[model samples]
Target: MQLQKKTRSGSFNILGISIKLSIVILIFFGVVFLLNKVDFPSPKKTIEKIIPNENFKIVK
Candidate 1:
């Protein structure tokens, strides 16, 4: 009876790990797909358009 319980616990642990790993992998691939679909411009262009001058700087 003790041995059976240990084996069941081990199987549950493996099943849990596999499920978590699959979820993480799915999310990673989804992010990659979304990034590829979107059009991202150069950093310089984005900065220039968003902040045209130095007046928007914050002083610490």
Candidate 2:
């Protein structure tokens, strides 16, 4: 009787863990889907800089 209880409890634990894992996966995908639907702004201004050769070091 004790052995039977142990096996049944182990199965229940596995089932619970799988359910929680699937829920987490679903929530992650839902967040990704919502983010895809939204539009984000892009940077419009362009800046240019020139670096002098004196700032660089030559390595062997």
Candidate 3:
């Protein structure tokens, strides 16, 4: 009766919140991936800089 109706509505609200959170997570990861692909270079360069020179020694 009344309890059933409330449960249904609550389920829908929970579903909507889940969808929104998932979208936000996806967008955050997408932006990170795009930035990485673009050679944004912050994290990558920082790691490279921290490593010893032998680690970056030219292969050719």
Which candidate should be chosen as best, given TM-score against the real structure? 2
Query: Residue by residue across 1-60, what tens digits does model 1's lDDT show?
Result: 355434344335778789999999999999999999999876665443465686678879
Off by over 4 Å in 1: 1-12, 42-60
How does candidate 2 score on lDDT? Answer: 0.87
Clashing pairs in 2: none
Q: Compose the digit string of candidate 2's lDDT tens values, residues 1-60.
A: 355434444345778789999999999999999999999998899888999999999999
Q: Which regions of candidate 3 fall more than 4 Å away from where they truly are?
A: 1-12, 40-60
> Could you tell me which residue pairs clash in candidate 3?
none
Score each candidate by Cα lDDT. Answer: 0.79, 0.87, 0.75
Enumerate residue pairs that collide in model 1.
Answer: none
Clashes of 3: 0
TM-score of each: 0.48, 0.66, 0.46
Tens-place lDDT per residue, model 3, 1-60, is: 355434344335778789999999999999998987885535545433466677676767
> Of the candidates numbered 1 and 3, which has the greater lDDT value?
1
Q: Candidate 2 has what TM-score?
A: 0.66
